[model samples]
Target: MINLHGINCPEWVSIGGDQRRFDDSGKPVDPSTADRAERVLATFVRLSSKVSA
Candidate 1:
């Protein structure tokens, strides 16, 4: 049996800061601005496919 525990964990919706800004060390602070929705939607489609199939 596939364990579906914690499937809807709130951490799944967490978003990081925009990566347009750089930190003092010249590194991207957080690069999650783009593709957040696309990634989540992809995951939903994948999981749903598994369940339906």
Candidate 2:
């Protein structure tokens, strides 16, 4: 895991083709796979804020 809860990763990248998403047609959906990146980034920010508070 890349510790997504601790960093903002908005780009979808392939790592040995194991970190990719697939569509209903069994094809890779590269662009849509990073949708959670922003959410993860937001979570990190929230957690950090709590810790700093």
Model 2 pairs in collision: none
**To one decimal, what is the Cα RMSD in angstroms of model 2 from the true structure?**
9.2
Clashes of each: 0, 0
**lDDT by candidate, in order shown:** 0.56, 0.56
- Candidate 2 achieves a global lDDT of 0.56
Residue 34 error, candidate 2, Å:
2.1
Tens-place lDDT digits, model 1, residues 1-53: 23854355222445454646657886445556435645667788787777676
lDDT of 1 at 44: 81
lDDT of 2 by residue, 1-53 (tens): 35754644344334346447567896557654455554556776776787676
Residue runs of model 2 more than 4 Å from their true location after superposition: 1-29
